[model samples]
Target: MAFEYAPAPESRSIVDIKPSYGLFIDGEFVDGHGSAFKSINPATEETLAEIAEADAADVDKAVKAARRAFRTWSRMPGKERSKYLYRIARIIQERSRELAVLESIDNGKPIKESRDVDVPIVAAHFFYYAGWADKLEYAGLGANPQPLGVAGQVIPWNFPLLMLAWKVAPALACGNTVVLKPAETTPLTALLFAEICQQADLPAGVVNIVTGAGDTGQAVVSHPDVDKVAFTGSTGVGKAIARAIAGSDKKATLELGGKAANIVFDDAAIDQAVEGIVGGIFFNQGHVCCAGSRLLVQESVADEVMAKLKRRMGTLRVGDPLDKNTDIGAINSAEQLARIRALAEIGEDEGAERWAPPCELPSAGFWFPPTVFTGVSQAHRIARDEVFGPVLSVLTFRTPSEAIEKANNTPYGLSAGVWTEKGSRILHMANELRAGVVWANTFNKFDPASPFGGYKESGYGREGGRQGLSAYLKAGA
Candidate 1:
């Protein structure tokens, strides 16, 4: 007999989402010049709130606000700046339960994930950067490293609050004011964060949020005054941003897409490898940029690993994002769901064998079953491209050299994983994998103290730790 879990939904009462929201500029919520767009809960397709869309003019206003604030904010004593970050971090902790619920409702991730991973990391990022604000002289950026003026930041919907924290914390710690634009689908938490700034008594215009679609982001990036641009999203857009700022002086940092490889050697711990593979590819509905979507198992162990992986995949619970017991929630949007479907279809049409666990999806929401494709080759689209969903492609390697060759075949170089008991092999593989981050016997782990970024078409520039601080600071002359 199969065991069943009781429905345990988190209460939405803690969060009081408003009917409508506007641009957060100069520390105040103000009207946008453009039309409003509705933000919906991806799980149920229910309208959550109407978000004010920022126009080019609105973007200019936000830039001006950040520019004006930068004059006073950049010159403030380092100790004083650190206090505001500490206060923001504390306020986020005090309201974490509320933020987590809102994140689940707005972004369609599991309550467990929003509560455990996203919210905690968001607060920790702020806290970590807070201490750095007072110690930049010791940060090895030379004596009295100067701020880079205004930073234009754009974050994605996958890990909304955490991405916001990642961008905002380091920038502010380095004395740069910002005009940030949250993705259109999930703008609520960012608006709420603006309120947190007000509550922290942060000076007006120190952090500005201009909510909108791509055009608003273009405005911020192309603005003559923005000294720095930091974006986390697709590789195609990262290229566009790079092109837009080609002849300009704006410094840019991009965290883009990946097709990471997870290699399992014959002598590895099979059970632990299965768990790592699942967590790597299925976590966040596989919307992760560095998800281990490509599974490279040793030919000798492929059969055993596949059997165990299929068995484990069957046990995942897929349903309401609010349900504490839910493992996979909804796809972030109808558009993203369509993309996943299209790619899965291509996987089948290209002669790859597709498989999904026996799981019933909720009737109303945008859903895609956790899927895997076997008999995949490096030339196949499913193996080479980023599905950006809960889809994994399995391939076999005869030797370590073959594994390394197949893994680096992709144009992306974001992250990869290796599972084995051999310490020497592990160190050698870690050095050989052409990814910014490598996980040995583990995957998808992140910390605010560690720097994270990518290489080649995956984009460039670090986003955490001391290196992240340099993105907002000028090198000593």
Candidate 2:
């Protein structure tokens, strides 16, 4: 049965682009003289808002505001400071329905995911960190940890509001002010978050939301006054951020891209593995940074597992993101959809068999069929590049060593999944895998308290858990 959801009160899946957008600086929205750009809805290729393109000048303003607020907000008692976060979380819950609709409309994630996963998790993140405000001394790092001051956060479009919570909540808990920039492709939720801040009556200049393309992100990252730069995006951008932060006094944390391997041994539960594989890559149209895009199956059970995966994939419901029963949503953007198609073609040209479940995709929207490629080699472009769409590449391995080798072949080490009935194997593989978060018999698991990040090219630093709070802590405090 398909689930039904009340759409945004406006009921238009796509929001109209305002003539111009204001930069949320110093706790108030201000118009910027810098360039402006249009953010569009991927589901229908319609404009949602005309966002301000912050150049070096605009970033200076937002950073300055954050710096001003940090002097006061950072010194307030932790318990008293937490009240603002509590208010934000409450406002998020109150406006979750609107946020869910906005998220789905802008980012092309299923409404179910935006509602049940993104919205709730975002609220929980604020709520979780709100308690941590006064308890920093018990966070295992030490007593009286001070704020890092003026953090510059750059988030991706995959999970807009959720990523915002992951970045902002802990920063506040640890007493840092933040200047954040959402991806150019998806900025609605962040703008709405600014509204929530207004509703919370959070002090001005404590949290600033800037909207623009890559240059805007660069402005924030390369700014001199920024105490820390936290970014979640592709490995290419992650590398750029690392280099930019290097030789500078700024502290940096990156939650970059991943090409995680979902290893399924022959002894693993085939039924469970089938669902895991589908949910791994197909969830959120496979826009996840830690999405298990690689399926590393033991050769002994490859055929059976592959067959079952195909059968299961056939039953997936792909359609309107606002529809409750949609198992897959549209690709995040037109450029991303084109990239997926190009990569799937590359897989076919490289001699992999390409298959997609028999399904009709939306005609007028950015869409890509859930794709699978078999006979994948380690050297294939499809295997190497980060295809941020609903594409899966399959390969076979005969031994545990080979499984580990294939799983670690990519430069990404954000996450990996192991499926087996053997507890010993799970422990061994978890220890051996270089990924940050290892999933046993599961994939795509997330928590506000679970520290998540990547190793190697997948990027550095942790996003959740006690360790996450430390990112905002001042050094030598």
Candidate 3:
């Protein structure tokens, strides 16, 4: 069937983004001292908005506003804070469709995902954390379990709204004012979220948004008033942020890159394994931190598995992001597409055979075909690096031990998926795997309650569940 191009049913063009540049500080939009930069739609190359580039001064101003807000926000009773978070959650629900469309327009993610997965999960994060506001005493984060004051969060372009919720919800729930910088490629939803803050009547400076590239993020990390810094992005940038904050007393949590492994055993439910492998790499066009970029299959079942996987991949619909039926959308930005392509070339140069389903990609938009690399070795760049695209490197293993060895042979330990029929084997692998979020018989399964984060260079701390609250809590009885 040809890929469809139906408009998103709930989409409306109610918001106007004038050719303006500004900072969202103290509950209002104001000009940035820095020069203007264009934020283009990856799917069409349209300049959707010209966002204000944040310089060091803007970052400092935003941090100051957040520090001021923390005085009252951090001191407010837990019950009162809970109400505020709940209000934000309700407002997110009401304006979700608008936010979803904007996310697709700016980020080139399919409307189906932005609507079904991202938007709902973003709101659910707030709702789930909202209930925890007054209940932190029982969350097991030590004595008083108080706020960590002003937190500066830097999020990437992949899941703009969801990432914001992941960082902002917990901070607000624990009574921390936030200064968040959404990625330059996709700042629409975050800017839209600034409006949602007003709708929720969230206090001025409780949530301030600064928009820009790397230099601006550096400013946020180096700012003195930011007590804690949380970031979700590339390992390279995470390293820079870590280095920038090394001398300061400020605490930092990084949710960096990954080259996750999806291991399939011979006895696994082949159908479910096929689905898991497909979903693992294809979800959000594989622009996911925890994307299963590597697939390890038992040699006994490798041929059958690859055949089924090819058939499954052939059915995915990739095109316009606003289309309700799009399975894979355009790459988020030109820079990301270039990165994906460059790494794929490196895969070829490093001696791996690439295979992609015959599908038509958008001509004007930034697109990379969903690719699979065969004849892969543990040392192949495709197998080792975080490609951050819908590219899979397939490697066959003769034994369970070999599979584990190949899976762990990476600098990242963010997520992994295991497929097998044996419960003992599942438990054994789960215990052995070093990744933060492990999925058996499934891949890319996320929840507001499940704790999610990585080990090693893939970064530290957990995002959801009780562990999430710990990041925001101060030890005082």
Model 1, 18-95: lDDT tens digits are 999999999899999998999999999999999999999999999999999999999998899999999999999999
lDDT (tens digit, per residue) of candidate 2 on 1-477: 534444332354344335556889998888876778888878788777788777788899999999999999999999988999999999999888888888898898888898888999999999999999999987766666788889999999899999999999999988899999999988888988998899999999999998888989999999899999999998889898898889988888999888999999999999998898888999999999889999999999999998999888888888888787788888888788888888889889998889998888878889888889998899998888889888999999999999998898888898999999999999999999999999999999888888998899888888888889888885443
Query: Better model by lDDT, 2 or 3?
Result: 3
Q: Which sections of candidate 1 miss by over 4 Å?
A: none
Candidate 3 structure quality by residue, lDDT tens digits, 13-91:
7546666647899898988988789999899898887899889988888888998999999889889999988999999
Question: Ranking by lDDT, best first?
Answer: 1, 3, 2
For model 3, give the 10-residue run with minimal summed lDDT. 3-12
* Candidate achieving the largest TM-score: 1
lDDT of 1: 0.95
RMSD of 3: 1.6
Model 3 vs. true fold: TM:
0.97
